[model samples]
Target: MEAMMEQREGVALFTICRPEKRNAVNFVVMEALEGALSEAEADERVKIFAITGAGDEAFCSGGDLHEFGPLRGAEAKQMLTRMGEVLYRLLTFPKPTAALVNGAAMGGGCELATACDFRFVKEGSRIGFIQG
Candidate 1:
């Protein structure tokens, strides 16, 4: 799974599971994130939503350019639009949210962290926007 969801102690923890790619965002990760958010929103037991990466090396590196590099004009546009909608929903979510920044968070990863209500960054972790 590109992402996984675990609910415990009233928190729904959404983890991006592509450590090999530095937890980079791809279509699969996007879908999984969206689904996790939706599920947590509807589940009354979940009072908090938290997001993080699989490994300690990176919270997230941003988009997987290697996976998306082949897209043409319309395809790229559609993907970007969808991701934007997902972020918008997260930003407006009713419940409190948290971003667990375990390591490096760059580009879109930085955006994702900001979307949450609060961020808990690990010691020595770095967060920056490198989007161009």
Candidate 2:
């Protein structure tokens, strides 16, 4: 699985677990993340949220270029719009939200981190929008 969900001290931690792919962000991953966020928000036990990548290589490396070719312009637009909405939900999550950036955070990965209210980055890690 590219994503994993766990709870600790009322904090719902959603970890992207695709190290071989450098934690590349994909539509499916985004949807899974959104689902986890919604689930946490609705759960009475959850009071915080966190996001991180599995390995040390990357937090997320934007969208999967391999999957983008078949996506039409309209589909791409819709995907981006939906991603924005999901990010908005995360950004405005009622409780404290934090991003654990331990590695490269490119494009949507950086966007995802930026959406959170707080970010804790490891030393020597890259955190920014990369490759558009």
Candidate 3:
């Protein structure tokens, strides 16, 4: 599973499950995030949405370069558009949203964190937007 969702005490916690990849967001992760976000948004019992990563090493490294580096024209555009929509949804989520950055959050991961209304970072955590 690329992602996991757990609801506890009216809080919806969504975790990126690719610890080996530093919880990078590939297409699979994006899709899983979308589904999880939709479900959380629709559930009236979910008072807050929180996003995090599986391991302590990183909250998210960024987009999976190996998976997305070879796109040409239209394919890249489509993917970007889709990701933009997802981010927009996150940014404008009806309920409160938060990014719990336990570690590094680079590139798209930084964007994800920023989309949330609140961000809670742990000690020694790093976050930035570095386009390559």
| Alpha carbon lDDT of each predicted model | 0.93, 0.87, 0.94
lDDT of 2 by residue, 39-121 (tens): 99899999889999998888887777776557888998887798889889988889889999989988888988899999999
For residues 1-132, what per-residue lDDT tens digits would candidate 1 score against the true structure? Answer: 889999999999999999999999999999999999999999999999999999999999988999787888999999889889988888988999999999999988998999999999999999997647
Q: Residue 22 in model 2: shift from native, Å?
A: 1.0
- Lowest summed lDDT across 10 adjacent residues in model 2 is found at 61-70
lDDT of residue 32 for candidate 2: 92
Across residues 55-128, which tens digit of lDDT does each residue of candidate 3 receive?
99999998888888897699999989999999999999999999999999999999999999999999999999
Model 2: clashing residue pairs?
none
The local lDDT score (0 to 100) that residue 120 gets in candidate 1 is 100
Q: Per-candidate TM vs. native?
A: 0.96, 0.93, 0.96
Clashing pairs in model 3, backbone N/Cα/C closer than 3 A: none
Error (Å) of candidate 3 at residue 35 is 0.8
Off by over 4 Å in 1: none
The TM-score that candidate 2 achieves is 0.93
